[model samples]
Target: MRSRRGVIEVNTAQIREVADGVPDVCIYELLYNENIEVIEDQCLSKRKCDSAILASDGTVGIFVKPDLPEEYRQFLLWHEYGHFKLHYDENMHFNFYLSRFSWKTEREANTFAALNLLKGEDIYDQNVIALLISKGVPERIAVKTYESLI
Candidate 1:
């Protein structure tokens, strides 16, 4: 599916809106309806990336480093999905050795992932990291994303 493009000024609330569009969890199941193909690549992390997306020919593909634990793999998939939904510039590179992704963009993706993963949870009343862990978010990312959110 084509992204809502030209939105370079996205915020956490905006990401929340995007997550609201998704009716439920199990992103792996949702991607098919979104016309996104998922691929498990053993070499992804060898390239210095946990996950990445490739958009082409009216289909978006999310490639993940399968070596990661299942929870982290799911988180990475959501993160890349955030990129696809938000800043989906076709020219978005693989983020080369000389050109890392912008910090803000990465953070936005993580925020989207966290928001979506914990959509039905009461983040205000619980330990955020523990909550995220229960929902399959990695402890490190859960901690950092929780910290960033607060």
Candidate 2:
């Protein structure tokens, strides 16, 4: 919410600040939660699975897979945090994961993630998707990553 630049984007620094108070963030180094999981392809390619979510208490459980550069991980975590902060308030009755179908909540959560992470501002002119590409972020995550910022 509060950023030094005064522009609100979905950058990792802002994300960390946003999630400063929330608890139980599980960032696995290699393994995934199966249900809620993040993965990083450890071979020749530095590809990472990005993130996952689980329903926990009044909050949504978040998981960030390993293998991303610190900056990218920050984005992924914020995305999950977006799910927690935005989606949790309105749609508590529905369980997102078990539905076996994508819902509007997920899209809203992603939008929150993008707005925070991408924080459209002049300083960071390029969108998150472009930034990720410039930084060599894996293609698999480009879509969601793009959605989050742009």
Which one wins on lDDT? Answer: 1
lDDT of 1 at 66: 73
lDDT of 1 by residue, 1-150 (tens): 222442355777787788788778588888877889889988775787778888886678999877678877788888889988877766654442233446767788888898888877766767888978876776777888887777
Local accuracy by lDDT, each model: 0.77, 0.48
* Candidate 1 to truth, TM: 0.80
Pick the TM-score winner: 1
Off by over 4 Å in 2: 1-50, 54-61, 89-93, 100-103, 123-128, 132-150
Instruction: Estimate candidate 1's alpha-carbon lDDT, on a 0 to 1 scale.
Output: 0.77
The alpha-carbon deviation from the true structure for residue 54 of candidate 2, after best TM-score superposition, in angstroms, is: 4.2
Residue pairs with backbone overlap in model 2: 8-119, 9-116, 9-119, 10-116, 10-117, 10-118, 10-119, 11-117, 39-49, 114-148
> Clashing residue pairs in candidate 1, if any?
none
